[model samples]
Target: RLERLGARFEAASPLGNGQCSAPHPLTVTALADGVALEPAATLNCRAAEALARWTTEVQVAAQKEFGESLKSLALGGTYVCRGQNHDTDAKLSEHSFANAIDVMAYGFTKRASLKVTAAPDGTPEAAFLASARTGACTFFRTVLGPGSDAAHGNHLHLDLRERNAGHRLCQ
Candidate 1:
């Protein structure tokens, strides 16, 4: 049986941090059953459909642009504290609920790889990130790579939640 990871969104709180209006936290849960399954997020049910669609697109793009040699995908950022750039109030993370995804690794089997913070910065890492960002996959509504921000120096922040419906502040 195939399983689609489902995530749920929880409104951001101000108790931890003064910022909570950004992407809400997500609560992801796994379901096991017998059925032809498809990958899915636990974001808003409506948004989940979109997220699932986009995720597949990103995978395809990665393979097509990077290579069929690509293996497991690495993650960096996911659900985090929603706020303006660099604004933190010591609150819970936006991913506290599971609304976000941080890409940190991408291995081509146990051999070739493209993992953020996995290998020291060099020509290989540079090329990996460059290709992923420029590949133009429609899976993630937004893709934040190195140079996007210092905090993102080692990974790509992939959010599959509602954007513009409110706004996208991730980088």
Candidate 2:
């Protein structure tokens, strides 16, 4: 289904066990619909689907707002078997289960890439980032970005963790 939708990916072998494990993993290298992820990323099927949709949907709006179409996504990484913020003693993060992706920047075809940050005070670029962050809540169960926390001060963290009552964490 994903391949038919123009998602370029390859299935990954299951990893780990017990508290830190990822099932049905996939290494998605690109979204053939026009969005390219820098260095690619690995994620679970559901997370990958949500990412593709979010990028596709946001790219149109981003282009209209910024006068430039997005061409690539700069990712911090995905599918790391670690606890939140890499705290070994802490609970595992959604990334540990291949259910999350960290977006550090956005590349445009006609302009320099936009770095995800809380600095520079106010600017059209910041506005666009805000809009994109808010828009992500529609597709991801958890959306953490710049102002969310120090750990997420430089990247947007999106995940597909199911919650009761369709609860969502958008910060």
Candidate 3:
């Protein structure tokens, strides 16, 4: 599906893990749906697909609501070999397995980018951000944003973590 949509990516070698590894890792540099990434990202195919879908949906929504098309996706990072909150003793984060992405901002075609922030009071950009966060819940297993926690204060954390009984964490 991602290939059909014009996403440019390459398969990566398996990475480290005692429990599991991303056998099908991918480095995505561009999206066919017209969304751009601030920096190229590497992720599991599933995570990449979900991000592409979410970006497309969010861009369309923003166009309808704010009359602006998305120019680029500001990413914090991806495919990090780290534990939750970078605590070595803590459980491994989805990022360690290439199953997560951190979005920092959304650049628009017509105006300035809308950065993710805790102080998303009442504004059109805030509303757009809220809508993107809410809509992302449908595609990702976890969606952590501004109010989720101090650790995720400035960026949106999206991941495809498997949960019991199909339960999802969307905060």
Candidate 4:
């Protein structure tokens, strides 16, 4: 199913530390219909699946908003052993378990790449970004982007962090 969605990847060595781990990780190189992931990403299957699904929606939004196809994604990071928000004292981040990704920007086939930051309120980029962020909530349990907080001011933080009662956090 993931292959049909255009996700190109290979099995990766398991990731682990005393505090965090992912038993079966994968290195994802591309997503939905050839959209590349710059520098690729190491993720657990569930997180990779969510990213593929969300990318499919973002591809459609790009065509509708700019009449162009998405080319690549500038990823900040995927799997890392770190605490939430990089605060060592905080709880372990989803990234620690290869369950999260930070998207820094989106590249298009023709239009200039769009960074995940605050854009002019009425611009096409802003609208497209808004649509992309909102659509991510359908696939990811947690979606944090610009204006969510100081820690997430410049990138979209997406994760499959489960919560009580199936609650979702879309900030």
User: How many residue-pair clashes does candidate 3 contain?
Assistant: 0
Top TM-score hit: 4
Clashing pairs in 2: none
TM-score of each: 0.50, 0.92, 0.93, 0.98
In candidate 4, how many Å is residue 162 off? 0.8
lDDT of 2 at 52: 86
Model 2 lowest lDDT segment of ten: 118-127
TM-score for predicted model 3 compared with the true structure = 0.93
Q: Sort by TM-score, best first: what order?
A: 4, 3, 2, 1
- Taking the tens digit of each residue's C-alpha lDDT, what string does model 1 give over 36-147? 1122233433334444444444455455555554434444444344543345554344454354556566555335665664334555555555655554235455556666
Question: Residue 16 in model 4: shift from native, Å?
Answer: 0.7
Candidate 1 or 3, higher lDDT? 3
Could you give candidate 4's per-residue lDDT for residues 103-139 as a string of tens digits?
9999998878999999999999999999999999999
lDDT of 1: 0.46
Candidates 2 and 3 compared: the better one by lDDT is 3
lDDT of 3 by residue, 1-171 (tens): 888866888888887767546778888987855678889888998899998888878987788778978878889978888889888899899998899999999888889888888544787877788889998999999999888889999999999999999999999
lDDT of each: 0.46, 0.85, 0.86, 0.95
Name the candidate, 1 or 4, with the larger TM-score value.
4
Model 3, position 122: C-alpha lDDT score: 84
Compare the candidates by lDDT and give the number of the best one: 4
TM-score of 4: 0.98
